[model samples]
Target: MNACIVLCLALTAFLANAVAQYETCVADTAIVTGGTPGVTVSIGRDEANEMVQITLVGPSDVWFGHGFDGLVMANNYGFIVDTSGVSERRFGTGYSVPTELATTSIVGTPETSIVGGDRTVVIERPYSATDA
Candidate 1:
């Protein structure tokens, strides 16, 4: 009976993962040019929790963020790299606002790193019904 229970648990885990993989949607890759040449951004979403994942690859020591409603405006979340090569997540509102740290409805860890001469950042957050 113990062996059977273990097998069932393993199968259950496998099935759950399979279902999650099937519900994932990947957006088209976006190419960005300018200060950080060859920069590419890709976004993906999973139906389970409407979680969105953003991946960015660009030149090292560059900052990147996703702006909603406009460029560098409110509802923007991104990562900034200081001169010492340390990266930190930052949330801000647009200049038109009161110039304060904007609140975010996103839920997850946003991180950035420099690897192989490329800067990579991955951010994940669930979709808020009020976001739209």
Candidate 2:
């Protein structure tokens, strides 16, 4: 669906942000489509800390997710989000449910909130994977 593609575009943009800080990093935003109310995506780059902050706000009633690097699920990396929050990062090779990553990749703790029938999920990660 178009909405799903828009959400995925957010992730794809963030993926490009992995190497975006050639100079001062600026935050970017987009009003996502597809959802009844629509979703808002914000991506901020932390040049000093080499991190990227991504925020997604969407309807609380239905679960949503962001997929990166691939249009289809095959070998796609993504995560599911709900009112509760993100549980884990996942990778998939098919249309079925993706399995959690063997190792944690999040640079720091993620935060979430649900208010007024809207769910907001904020995730922060380094430009690269966290050190093992």
Candidate 3:
């Protein structure tokens, strides 16, 4: 009976590790014409160490001049909890490039993929008066 308990524990640990082993990194792009230009984003598992990483390449010559305002949304993807059974539906945002490209990372614990299957990386450019 004791052996069976140990086996169960071992199995649990194995599954936990397996689930933790999945990681993903993806690079996406967003086009801006008027207001908040966004890009179609997709993130999938690659290796075990890096769950998800997203890169946004700005449109050519799409300069912010001063800076850029951007936000990343990971609404729903997969893996809500980790081995210890903790809420993992994490969401984050940040700034991107400066007169060039823009990028942000919605980093989370256990390295889970970004949520909201069809992730949208929105780049809210600083309103330019001269262009209009």
Candidate 4:
């Protein structure tokens, strides 16, 4: 098993305002059959800024992230945040640390905090970034 291996996601996109400081409403709900408890991944669109905000919450001892627009880790553009509130916009290429693309422009900073033994990382980036 690989990424999203232990944790499964049931993605749903809603084009409406979300509750509690979200720009747009979209989430990956947990399935009762076999889902990772106390884990969540939520995506919201910041229409005013033309960006997307990803909010992830999970165990405070490990790192977590979300990737999109590709098939495999190496093919995707993603943000990975460690437990200490450090994050990177990485273009994965292997099992080791990923490298950021030279032509890509990552916007804003990733924020992470641990409370109640849960780590929450929030990242914002351009909705459609240029590779050139």
- Prediction 1 TM-score vs. true: 0.53
Q: lDDT of each structure?
A: 0.54, 0.66, 0.32, 0.63
Misplaced by over 4 Å in model 2 are 1-37, 130-132
Ranking by TM-score: 2, 4, 1, 3
Q: If scored against the real structure, what TM-score would every candidate get? A: 0.53, 0.63, 0.22, 0.59
Model 2 — which ten-residue stretch has the worst lDDT? 23-32
RMSD score of candidate 4 (Å): 14.8
- Runs with alpha carbons beyond 4 Å of true place in candidate 1: 1-28, 31-36, 70-101, 129-132
Model 3 lDDT, full chain set = 0.32
Tens-place lDDT digits, model 1, residues 4-120: 999999999999877533233544344333334456667777767677776667667555433344344455544443334323234444454322234554455557677798777
Please write out the lDDT profile of model 3 over residues 4-121, one tens digit for every residue: 9999999999998776332333344232244335333334553535343333322233321111233333222212222232221223333422121132223442222334432223
Candidate 2 lDDT (Cα, whole model)?
0.66
* Separate clash counts for every candidate: 0, 0, 9, 0
lDDT of 4 by residue, 1-132 (tens): 554643443222232233234465768543222434776778888677677777778778777665566655675666566655644556646775676566545555677778998888777667777651
Residues 48-127 of candidate 2: C-alpha lDDT, one tens digit per residue: 77877777777789887666656555675666787566755556555766776777667566878889988888777777
Give the Cα error of residue 63 in candidate 3, in Å: 35
Better candidate by TM-score, 1 or 4: 4
